[model samples]
Target: MIGTLDKAKLKERYDICIVGSGPSGMTLAAELAYSGLKIAMIESGSFKRSSLAEELKEVQSEKLPIKANSRERVVGGASSTWGGLSALLDPADLAHWPLSFDELLPYLKAAAKYHFPSLETFQNPSGTGWKFKNLADKLFVAVRPPFNFTSLVNIFNRKGVDLYTEATVAKLVSQNGRIKKVLCRSVDGQGFEVSAEIFILACGGIENSRLLLVSGLGNEYDQVGRYFMNHPKGYAGRLHLSKPLPVNNYYLPRVVGGRMVYAGLRLEEELQKEKGLLNACVQFEPDLGIFQKYAFAIWRRMPGFSTKVLTIFLPRTLRARWFADMEPRAENRVILSDKLDRFGSPLPKVVYDLSERDKATLEELFSQLRSGVERLELGKLTGTAADVLKVVKDDASHHLGGTRMGLSPQESVVNTECRVHSSENLYVVGGSVFPSAGCASPTMTMVALSIRLAEHVKSKLASKPRRTFKNQTSRTSSQKILIIGAGNRVRGDVLPVLESLPGFEITGIFARHASSLFGAHRSYDVRTMESLSVENLKGARFLYVSVPRETLAQVLSDLPGASSLEVIIDTPVLPAVKKYAHKFKRIHVAEDSVFLPWLDGLKGREVKEIECSQSVFRYHGMALVKAFGPINYGYRLGNKLYLKAGNTKVKIIEPRDYASGKLKIDGQEPDLTAIIAELIPEERGLLGEIKSTDTIVSKMGELKRVGLRRLLLAASRGEETWSLEEGLNDVRIDWLLHKVWIYLSI
Candidate 1:
């Protein structure tokens, strides 16, 4: 099922755990559907692009110009933002690979079928067969609509896999030279472990190396994070033809089988082999007028309104855009930077540069392409070889070759099967495993490798007897609960906490506005209800209410009085519980502060005194009073209130507004994630003082709020909980605080 890792409890183990949900990971998972091997696909990013994901992927690029958004950190990886340019690697690109072109052709065809608009769209056009004057056609195909792999959400259910988004794998734990488990943490800082029989790293080219370096794995012979590559792309030169010789044949996009096909020119593979040159491809685009160029730029930034404007405008000249593959150099690599991300993992430092041969290849390809156009009497090219040499270089967003696959450990990180050479049950996929990159888009080739890996794994598993796994039906079965609100509190906290636990199915949601109802349609399935009907609430034993005061009153008054019904209302709406207590069988006012990690240390302990200083006296004082009770006397000195309890001293310091961005830790600007990490040691210290698990301390406030799980479990068993009397007493303390405040002001 598709659920976020922060809110979903993953199974303890799986047959395989893939660490990325990119094109490669998604393809591999889909290919293994119905294989009877349970899978867990963990994605560091959420379904959308998030700031945390962006920050986590921060890279220190030394030479290659890698933009901040060059590599997408989302469910579909870079495919989410890509233009859907699809093509296969040239056969010469596989020269350094352990496997040959013929062996990989089937998977390539399968990938093309899966990604292309149609199978026929991938076939080359007839006649000279795209070969003329020692130049061949490099096909570029674009689907009618881009193929975003995240649309494969249903595969989770069909494949019996659990897709966990917003979960970042921290380290791979190895035992006896094999990966044993992975320690993962949600972006919100909830840490957990996932163990599996096999582990695959498909977290992109740079990330594959960074993870290996961080985990101290697969670096034998110091080849784990070396030989990084990206297609160096730029406008090499401008070609001014003698005549406008059918520019449509080169510049215009051809509509073929529901796809836009562009035939780019490249050096013949045989010629490249003969000259010992790198793979290079160049496509021609007609230069636009000043107004048209400006319009195009604006349209690119704001795509909704520029298409018609561009169609009305026309171009003036044609130019050559070059994309050349870089030679894999041992010095070009991704290493762990000393700088840490919010998760405390080292950032990837990329030391990448194009080789002299790389530049010469581009120059040579441009010269040959210009020579052919002139030989064909198309036009006399204007831009010279000097212009080609000065081509402004930028990364093509095609990150490849770190942890490259090959035949030996000394030269590669993975073998022909994409398995790590030194470690069994560990495999690598994606462009990271490409021993050589062609001057084509890498996504299609990566998909092929992923499919190949799936077949290899399937054969490896076929020989071994299948192991029986424990059924998880009992944990996720049909105990129903209906949510009564669709506000931030309900969507952000209530639904996630309740959904994380077992034995509860959210049946439906109730909201006044259609927008609110639409907002509640999260990863899981939940029908939106018009009103609280008998049919909607048929099996629901509990109702979670977190609306405003008026809405709570209306909802509580309208509730059906079944003895099985229980109400868990927010603490602010305690008066609603008092008014409607008799209508429901049980009521629990959720005061999450009582379950906070700091407060958990005070539970069941005698407090001698309490020192409180803060605004929001009702909320703050109630938390302290509820946790440590039976105050004999209270004294106010200055701004602080001192309370006498039994013997233990309780100090509630002036709470800092962490969200206001004013708090600082160790002279550094306040970052919520960093502050949370810093507080873990102190939270652990608090746990040491109390009888509590460290897991709760690890999640800090999130799990503390999730302590609502206990109340729900108690309600399920018809056990005792914070009763109406105690809830009223808690409110009375707030009432007393109000009276005291009025008196003091007067």
Candidate 2:
């Protein structure tokens, strides 16, 4: 349902919360809706453009020129001002990516299909029609109307999806390494909160980095706002043909299969790689105006010459425009300014610098292009290198590379899954996550990555055990289970699955209200805390506690003979609960992050060494233990933890060091799958060595004090650890301790 931000009417919780209703955010919302997960999308603007909202987009640029209409803050984002040009990133451009072209091809194809449903083919011819060795001929450029959310109005209205317009997320609230809530405010300055299981920042390139910086989120590697890039474009020259040549509609936008398509010139990928030159493309348009009219008048005076001129030479008076790639440089960056917006958020200060390589690349490319045209006798290029430089503009409105993707947190803001390095559930999607921007319009690539991200989210949701209704006419003597806390997780994640099983039935539920239990079976009795007694717990074979951590101990203590029953806690047990460990015969704490399926292979394989390079704050320790086995001995070397059992060795490197390219195992680069494998088995044994009141306080304090980025920097420099009182408060430390216990127990 599309509505204004009304905290009173909004649901208290959602499965996913997406910030910014741009192409990437909307595409992800549509893709994830198929899975039936409740989604909430928050946009800063409404359907129509607003001066107030647009004012927030104001940015100060240094060196590079900022386009006045570069970004839109409305419902559709930049799509509102986009000139739909679809093209894929060159394979050579993705050399640094962990994902290969083959891996990304399906998503790219899907994105193409989404944009052009009737697209028959995308293949371009090998060489330009002009016979020149270096001249690039047929370049694939698909033209379609800019993507607008209005086109997906019906999709946005889908059930379980809530889109809040004019609601801007100002900051993210983190607790125990998870984003628990988002503080949002309207343009009118009304404030509210939206909580969700997973949070995604799809608020364009500039805003993406800006929000993270203000919230002190994913900047662990100091790479969040760096490597800013844009496709530098300018007038190359004019083409004067030696002979009248027939120019086809391929050079111009023409309707084909009910969609607009155009073909331009791209330096072949092989040629660019061979020459060690950057990717660049050029397009030609007939130089129309007074010159064309006068030429036509002169040509009409000679019938024979006029026929040739009308057929070919008229189309030869073409203007050339060049688009070239910009190398990713650290100096080109976006940072927060001292000035604040109306909402009190810092305005982004973009510092863009065109490198010497960029200038040389353009000069070399146009020179080659001029030679190619002249050599083929196709045309004579007019305009010197100086003219090209003078007319060039850095405002393609293609803002890219702020929250780039890399293998580790130190190298980039997000991981391969697009999840933030320090936070497990936080993700960022859009051009901001691009590690490098090739000389192609970013819309196509952004859409493809959004599709991939949607799939990943869906898979993660599917991996969690949720409720599924089943019909059963007969009931037999089965195990009776008592459940506490009638919240979303119990009702949505536990009840349905439990009811579907033939051998189990929910005997009782302890919650504030019975009506809150969704699809509640009549046979099950619901009771409040005061009314509950030992008689209700008698004969119940299994007791499941899904209550808040604070009340868990009280709830467990209230039940008599609790030691006789099997207890399963939804959350990780606290260290304080160890004193009551003897009360329950078998205590099981659910650890959702652990995937048992990943351990399908390697039963007796002789594994050498395992290296886990993950964010220390968001590490999956228990899952590691279950995957590997028992650890015999372990020690810490600086920020890395090393554990060994017989022949296999496990190393847990700090996330920043991993991203800085410091962690290596057996001379091999860090692999997440392999590292987690080694790190998991040794988790249980190593847990005791690393577990301490001071250590836990120190880590959490570091996370809060400097944020993940600065915390990593301090750890790398071997800075002094914070004291318990100076560290995270007792409540947060208690939460951290419980998480550690969960990992150790698992």
Best by lDDT: 1
lDDT for model 1? 0.68
Q: For candidate 2, what is the total of clashing residue pairs?
A: 8
Q: Give Cα distance to truth, residue 118, candidate 1, Å.
A: 5.4
lDDT of 1 by residue, 460-554 (tens): 78865554433322357666788876655665466545644457767767754322121111333233345568766667787887777656777
In Å, residue 11's CA in model 1 sits off its true spot by 4.2
- Taking the tens digit of each residue's C-alpha lDDT, what string does model 2 give over 250-322? 5543444424445566666676778776666677656765675575345323333443344454565777877
What C-alpha lDDT does candidate 2 achieve relative to the native structure?
0.64
In model 1, the runs with Cα more than 4 Å from the true position are 6-8, 117-120, 126-132, 245-248, 291-316, 463-746
Model 1: residue 657 alpha-carbon error in angstroms: 30
Measured by TM-score, the strongest candidate is 1
Q: Rate the local accuracy (lDDT) of all candidates.
A: 0.68, 0.64
Model 2 / residue 198 / CA error / Å: 0.7
